[model samples]
Target: MNLSEFMNTEIVAGNTLWRITGLFGLLLVGFTAGKLLKFILSRRAEQLREPRPIIAATLGAIGRAAPFLAFALGLAAGTSLLVLNGASELVGTCVAIVVTLAISWTAICLVDAPKAWMTQRAGQTESKLDDMLAPIVSKSLIATIVVLTVVQIAQILSGKEITSILAGLGIGGLAFALAAQDTIKNLFGSMVLLADRPFEVGDRIVVDSTDGTVETVGMRSTRVRTLTGHLVTIPNGELANKSIENVTKRPHIRRIFNITITYDTPPAKVAEAKAILEEIMKDHEGMDPEFPPRVFFNEFQNSALNLFCIYWYHPALWWDYLALTERINMQILERFNEAGIDFAFPTQTVHLAGDPSRPLEVGVKGS
Candidate 1:
């Protein structure tokens, strides 16, 4: 309102209030342009058949900072409207730094976006190994980038070597490294499992006296659904070292048993029994024909003639094989009965030719 105050304050053609209002107008334009840019970029991203997150992310980052860069430019232009002689140069430098930093942040986003997207996608796979690896890779990438960023920031601020920054963190870093020892070892173990592929998810395996189908393989441990209906978690560190037997991986299962007949069974009848058994093995759908089943008179036991039989079941599933076995056994019994072949029982004959009257002075051990 006073003459001296008004005269000194008016650096541009307009009063201070008018200049301030123009500054705001320019900022408003910057804000509107940034929003328009963001919308167009995001809409175009949505049109892509498969979104490559890196592309979308880089554009998104630039769109977000466009307004800030415009605002800084406007502010730089407005610097002459003030009374400070040094303000223009300082504002220009600041604006340049801000633009550079914004672009740098966008680059970082470009690198980081794909990893995050990949981690998310890996979780959708049927294999449990992928699920375990995704998070570990994601977190490791994040941690490494963060540490490097901090060290760079330090080097920029203090003009020190990267080595100096590392030195300062030594004690704390040592403690953290010590604590993560087991975790690191387990991660390596999981990596070994992935590479070796001893067993996969849903495989029935026996390891360390535990029998089950593998439920999940994780970075730290593997979960198994045991035959007894319990879940057992074994650390990957131990699992990698154990001998794992993948039972389901075998081609076929073997069955060996004996069929008994009375000692008095005629040799001709015995030969017929063996022939019938071989036929049964051949007639079954699941029996492995290449390995031809065998039935032979092995030996005469305490009270019976023993027939040794060997056979195989293909497509080796436990329940399926067992049911097939039951059917084969019943069929054998039926066929033998029809042929008048007698199964064995314990029998003994006693000699009493000269002991009929002397039997009063003698006794049978098991009479």
Candidate 2:
């Protein structure tokens, strides 16, 4: 057969040979073009990444999604040449679904660019609000894209208007909302937490009985890494209701020290003890100028004299405060010993009516 005759020959499903060739030819061409474009964009994106990160990231995202989109488009175009009478609408609908999904997929991929940019920008700032908000915004955008994609696919498949579909979805959504009350509450609670700025990520906080460092604030729950190294997930709804103590926000740590001395010590020695403590705590390490160290002989008990001391340490760092406390205690011990002062201990004395040369006499009464 001549080339012209072969071109007109009947193929499978009554499609002419030329038409079949054209369909396959378009498919191959699309795939090849997609691959070439992806390679070029990927290389160029790499070169531009340092100078123009946002643009580079966007191009990279598109490059990653090129193959799938191009293949879907090619299939849609090729199917138009087929002579399937009743199946035409079905095929078209299927292609439309694929294309919709492809576009949505690309959109989702594109979200990565801005999401990363937001994350990078957030990291540069001192405020943690941006850090907490960036992920939420990115996830919300992706979710919106997915929902819209599903709706579009539904419209294509059912051949229904968007208004009708949305009306149906609204009724379904109401039932869903009613069924998922806790989830909704948690979502709103998360929003409240964000708005209130109660605590940020990495802040050590005490919520009710749970004391931990905030690890993450998510839609439903907040994860806390406890002191004992346990991870606790608290629902945002409940967390919002609880009182929160943000330990990380404290300006200083206050400490009250009580030093006891033996009662046998004379008034002069008691005064000296107080003076010694005042001298030992004077301008102590980590002490805040606004909250100077105070020392006084505040009380007298049966066994000892109570010396009260109050001091505030700036910055509220646990390890540094502990070191300062240890040094202060050692200094007090050394200073008191040098002054011949004895630390008080519990003791008792018993007296007898008749002992040694001492005796007791009682008067007799006649009735």
Candidate 3:
């Protein structure tokens, strides 16, 4: 139509062509603003070390958001030119509702961008736990966003703040709290385990009476592989309060024990035994040389003489320590046999101290 004819046409009842032109003008301005915003954000995206997929999409969404909002506002205002007296208020409320939803979704997506980037990078890491967490964290973020979005939608539709809804929860909130107590407590306990890092997967740990290697840490519990090959699951809530002995974190494994020699063993032989242990420890590469091996005549017992022995080994892997200990014990036994030194064994001597007429009474005393 010619410009004059278009200006004379009615878009809606009592809405002339000039008002329609104004709406289009507002839309054109909004479109221009959106394009400018996109150009600005594109420059920022180029500076990233590794530009993620969400960077472009998020920037695009944000760019289009302004124009979409402006267009909605202009359309709602244009409704006033219609014959309907309440059209403007109704359309404006609808526009506000739509904008609220769009804003909420955009905010959620922007927050999720970094997490998406992290998920992509997590696979490249050597840690299996981190690899597993990628999907778990992603899903968790999705669930959280969904819940928050539901709340946002509710507030927008109901036109009531969340605090007012909460205040009216009354008994329902109390019931929910009671039901979720254990879950929340366990959740916090898991957080503590993650933060404190008492032990990692594949590390041997002793908690309470249970001893095993940590297999995996889950949200509610930690799985363990025992030495006997049994799988044990301990709840994080219980684990957090337990005393954890992380064997892998130690600098050295200290070996302490008592070895007894028969009373027939001469004092010179006892000294020789100490020298033998010292020489054995010195030759072993795994043994800690900084801390000298010690063998001392601890005490004179009824059956044998006790020698207290102390030694330590570096980079304390349990298997390494056990293997070396076996070798040392065998060598000690062979040397003792060659030198005619006997290991202590339990023995007893019985004495009868009573009247001759009475039957023999056994009073047990032993050495």
**Strongest candidate by lDDT:** 2
User: Residue by residue across 205-318, what tens digits does model 3's lDDT show?
Assistant: 998878888887766678889888899999888899889999878999889988888887888998887677667666475766587678778899999888888888888877
TM-score, model 3 to reference: 0.58
Question: Candidate 1: where is the Cα deviation over 4 Å?
Answer: 1-162, 168-180, 344-367
TM per candidate: 0.58, 0.89, 0.58
Question: Tens digits of per-residue lDDT for model 2 on 26-62?
Answer: 7888788888889999999999888888888899999
Q: Which regions of candidate 3 deviate over 4 angstroms?
A: 1-140, 152-175, 350-367
Q: Over the full model, what C-alpha lDDT does candidate 3 score relative to the true structure?
A: 0.72
> After aligning candidate 3 to the native by TM-score, how far in Å is the CA of 90 from where it should be?
18
RMSD of 2: 3.0
What TM-score would you give candidate 1 relative to the actual structure? 0.58
The whole-model lDDT of each prediction reads 0.74, 0.89, 0.72
Cα deviation in Å at residue 305, candidate 3?
A: 1.7
Model 1, position 117, has a per-residue lDDT of: 64
